[model samples]
Target: MQKQETTRIKKEDKVKIIAGKDRGKIGKVIRVDKKKKRLLVEKANMIKRHVKPSAKNPQGGIIEGEGPIHWSNVMLICSSCVKPARIRMNILDSGEKVRVCSKCNENIDSK
Candidate 1:
């Protein structure tokens, strides 16, 4: 088995949808599936999935769910400035590491 490499995007992180039908929409990252390299952005790229009737559901119905979107199609939205910005690793004097926004030079986690 091979260990998968991840890009380190986290939940509650603001992001901008850059591709697919949800292009230009901005939202917080609700989930990150590292194994699949997919992301579930809050209120982004929703689709209906039809499912057969089960014991719980007597009738088959269409389920509204969030579809997996590739991570590449998303740009990290700076929490501080509230804009889509690139992330840069910064080390504090105390050796604490954090990601900062390249655009505003503000700490992405400060917000």
Candidate 2:
């Protein structure tokens, strides 16, 4: 029997917020929780949480941080033209696969 691969998005990918209070905000994916289908985006959808004192922090206090947002609420942003566009996979001459921006036909990982 052959093993199957999970087709979930990965970290460091650019994404744009499409819903919630932080709609339209774009940021790079810092982390992904596949079990929860939530993602932590850099500088996007920030929230405040109060913490109790512990060994690490003698004086625990309120901290501002980023919260996980649903994957359905975000659209992948293309690195090619630096815009929020749909993605389409393509094969290069060297047989390498790459994602392309459906709008600009440019390579997403040109950088």
Candidate 3:
């Protein structure tokens, strides 16, 4: 089995798609699947599902929703730079690890 790798991306972070049909699109991170190394970005990588009639849904039909995209395919958009940039881990004086934007050298973590 493949080991689950850690990701710098987190929920609510803005990201830009670097690859795939959704390339160049930007969206907020909705969910993260560490086991699959995939992210569910809002309004990105949309997929359709055929749902059968169930108690929850009296009318069964097609459903459109965001699909999981590989984490490597998206780049985090730096809040300071307002651009998609690489992230590096930084250890602050307080010993708290935080993500730093490579382009602007700004802390990605919100206070």
Which has the greatest lDDT?
3
How does each model score on lDDT? 0.84, 0.82, 0.93
What does candidate 1's lDDT look like per residue over 3-61, in tens digits? 33655578888789999999999888889988889999988999999999998877979
Name model 1 segments beyond 4 Å from true: 1-5, 54-56
> Which structure is stronger by lDDT: 2 or 3?
3
Per-residue C-alpha lDDT of model 2 across residues 1-111, encoded as one tens digit per residue: 322232234699989899999998988899988888789999998999999998987899988999999887888877667777876779999998887889999977656
After superposition, the stretches of candidate 3 with alpha carbons farther than 4 Å from their true spots are: 1-4
User: Which runs of model 2 end up more than 4 angstroms from their true locations?
Assistant: 1-9
Rank the models by TM-score, top first: 3, 1, 2
Count of residue pairs whose backbone atoms collide, per candidate: 0, 0, 0
Clashing pairs in 2: none
* Model 1 lDDT, full chain set: 0.84
Q: Pick the candidate with the highest TM-score.
A: 3
- Candidates 1 and 2: which is better by TM-score? 1
